[model samples]
Target: MIIGIVGGILQGMEAVYLCKHAGYTSLVIDKNPKAPAMYLADRSETCDVLKEPERAKQIFSECDAVLPAVEDLEVLEFLDSAMKEVGKPFLFDLESYRTSCSKEKSNELMARLGTPIPQPWPECGFPIIVKPSSQSGSIGVSAVKNEEQRLRALEKVAKLNDTPIQQEFVSGKSVSIEVIGNGKTAKAYVTTEVVLDSNYDCKQVVCSSNILPEKDDKEFVEIGKALGEGIGLKALMDVEAIYTKKGLRVLEIDARIPSQTPACICAATGINLLEELVCSKLGKESGKVRKDGCAIYEHYVIRGSALYTCGEKEFSHVEAPEYIKDFWGADEAITDFKTGKYEWRATVIFTGKDYQDAVHKKKQFIKNAMDNCELEEYIDRTPEMV
Candidate 1:
């Protein structure tokens, strides 16, 4: 099948990767010809959908389905309308996306559903998280310990012309689960652990059978289902949460295709989310079963003589990366690495029999890179509070 993917950035890269795994032809469209995913797709077009709606519609008509791999509301709505006019299935939910885009709205929905979430600021005390309600990832987010820091964080959000959401800083294992729905019902997929860098951007995703305790894992699945059904989600969405000592506290929800976790989940479990979504649209099941496996997906940047474990933001700077198998010691990688290149980036994937086995392979990957590149140092940084 030919899948038309819009917006060739991080999420676009993700859609292209999934299409590759599912044996589907990917056609990536982006205004910038040099967008990272443009090179990775089977076909690519350089066009801004909002600027040229007719041209976008014409391109999408040739594909079996269209998927919007962007968070911009304007672009997404344009693609939604274009897909509708073209009479093709658009793998996105605009209404659910409207709700999920704002932390204020989604937080209210979760609260009404009795899903655990971090307490509101002032009520929960110092060391709070102040973030923009509409921004994705770690953009315009801050961990503030006092009134002064809180004010500064608020100013940062104001600069983006966005509302600020203040919540108590909930620290624990960061976990995520994806859900797919057909409006009436929904299904939750595997859970993955999210590791963040010092800037609070995701640096790694670890997927395994034991990401959460059995009871918590079940609860997490139920939470994902509740949120999905609560929003009447029609496409795909992911729920992120912190598995704290008290219980599971949901962080936020994004009613769109996510970048990192799904890739890791696919590597660990045989079930491909994109394939399942497509099957659901056709009133069919993918018939793919899950396996008790483990996988680690991590990003790294090589600058000068140092190899640094980096976040998605840093990795996004990758230019015309290629997909490589058996990259270094890892199973596969999407990287810009070339022989004798002093600067490059890679998103490496490692799959194994269990979590420990995956970690062993990950260590070996690092060692191989160090030896092959003759790197002086390997650095991994983490958030100070977490």
Candidate 2:
């Protein structure tokens, strides 16, 4: 099968990665010639898809399905409409995207559905996290610790004229699960734990079996299904929640193929959401998706100055260069290695018989990698936190 993927930036890489593993050909499009996913795609074209959507559709006309792997809402709307006209499996739902686009809307929906969520702003008091209602991936997010900090964060939000959502600071391990559906049918997969940097932005993902407490499994899966059914989801999506002592506090829903979490899920579990979503749209048989073992995904970069790592895991979705395969127990390596360059970044995936085995392999592999390479100061991604 062939899939036409739009946007070769962040989320786009996973679409290509998943399809490649399934042995499906993928044609990727992005305006940037060096868009990270370009090298990994089976076929790639550099084009302004927003400007030349018709051209994109023509290029994608023969594909089995068209997938939008972009974060830009406008771009997704266009792709959804264009693919509708093309009469192929356009694997996204605009209404669902819109619902998840605004934090306020999603929070209200969850509350109405009787799902636990972070308490509202002042009612929950200081140390609340404030964020732009429509942003994703912790962009334009801030944790206000005091009245002064709250005032400053509010001013920052005012400068952008964006609606800010203040939620109680939820202290717990952040976890996300993937749900695939077509409104009438939705299925939630195993959970994956999110690793955060100091700024609370995702740095890596730990995909393992039974990451969620067995006690929370049924309720957590129910929350995902409730959101999917409420939003009438028609494709793949990720539901993020904080596993608090009380229960899973619904954080926010991203009604699109997420950038990092999905890949790790496949690594740890044997399920591939992309393949299932595509085949479902095509009305073809997609076999069961289940937990196979464990997988860990992390990122690092090598530059002439020093080796640095991505603040956003999988930020560099490149294949491993032949010179860089010293690490053992690595199930797969995708790196962006430019010729004669001092800088390069690649995401490495490792699979093991079980969770403990995978964690051990990751630690050993990272130790081997960092020790052999000359240390460049850690690539500190300055907090985009407001």
Candidate 3:
């Protein structure tokens, strides 16, 4: 069957990869002609997803399903409406998509449903995480330390043209929940703890280091699965949570496959999200999947902007193998190439003896890689005392 895929950036590329991997033909559309996913797609159309619904519908008419790979909520919402009009295959109920797309609304829903969530406030809280409920890549997310900081942050975020939610910033270990949803049911694929590279914000996300299977928190997984099932999630979903003194509080619930999720889940477990997504769309039962050992996905954050000076010693040349594998003939990679504003992008997927060791190894790789590379202009943002 053919899948009509939308968006064509990094996340879009990943979605296309998954669809092709599942043996499905793909029709990809994006505004950028140089979108990475276009490289391997069966067919492509360069258009703005928001203004080209008719064009998208024409493309969707030839496909079995229309799937959105990007985190653009407006486009997804439009697609949802169009899917209803055409009576085509889409995973979730439109209402569920609406609820999940809004961070503020999702928090309200989950909280009312008895899911643990951090206290949310539109205002009146310091050290708050100011995030646009719909944006991704942590685009506008900021930690405000005081009232003055909150006012300044709000003013800055106001220019973004989206309503922002301010909530208490919980500092502790961060984890991600990956789930695949059939229209009626969703199963938790795996839970992984993520450590942001030291230069995480600069590179956007250099790489994800460790995927510690949450065998210890099966109940939490069950709860999240119920949450997805309750919401009628039909596609891939990712819930990011932070472990705080209060407990496990969900930070964000994305109704689409997360960026780098393949490296996080598929690399850790044998379950491929793309296959599961196809199965879900076809109403097939997803088999039981579990994580083995510990898997890591690490990437490097080269300099992006020339706002800050780069250290000459920061950039070094090292010979790293192009690929590494965990199973027989199962190709996994430590790094990949992307010609963005940065110099290099790599991710290493490997299992460790335990969580700590897994994290240690991942950090070691980042440190070593950074040590060898020369930092060019560092992005100048607000520097704080850590």
For lDDT, the strongest prediction is: 1
Please list the residue runs of candidate 1 whose C-alpha ends up more than 4 Å from where it truly belongs after superposition: 382-386
Instruction: Write the residue-wise lDDT of candidate 3 on 1-386 in tens digits.
Output: 88777876556555665665567787888887766567557888887867777877777788888777765667777888888777778744556667777887898878777887777765436567777776665667778788788777787678887788888888767777777776677787666666553322322111122323344367557767978887878677777787776668788787776666565566556566777777777777658355455565544334443222111112112122133343221234433333353544343444554556556765564444444443344342323211
Better of 1 and 2 by TM-score: 1
lDDT by residue for model 1 over 191-290, one digit each (tens)? Answer: 9999988788899999999999999999999999999999999999999999999999999999999999889998999778998889988789898999
Report the poorest 10 consecutive residues by lDDT, candidate 3: 309-318
Model 3: what TM-score? 0.73
The true-versus-predicted C-alpha distance at residue 218 of model 1, in Å, is 0.3
lDDT of 2 by residue, 15-108 (tens): 8888876779988888888877777788888988789878888877878888888878788878878887888888888888888888889988
Error of 3 at 336 (Å): 7.0
How large an RMSD does model 3 have? Answer: 6.6
Candidate 2 structure lDDT: 0.77
Indicate the TM-score of model 2: 0.91
Give the whole-model CA lDDT for all candidates, comma-separated: 0.92, 0.77, 0.62
> What stretches of model 2 exceed 4 Å from their correct place?
303-309, 313-329, 338-341, 371-386
TM-scores, all candidates, are: 0.97, 0.91, 0.73
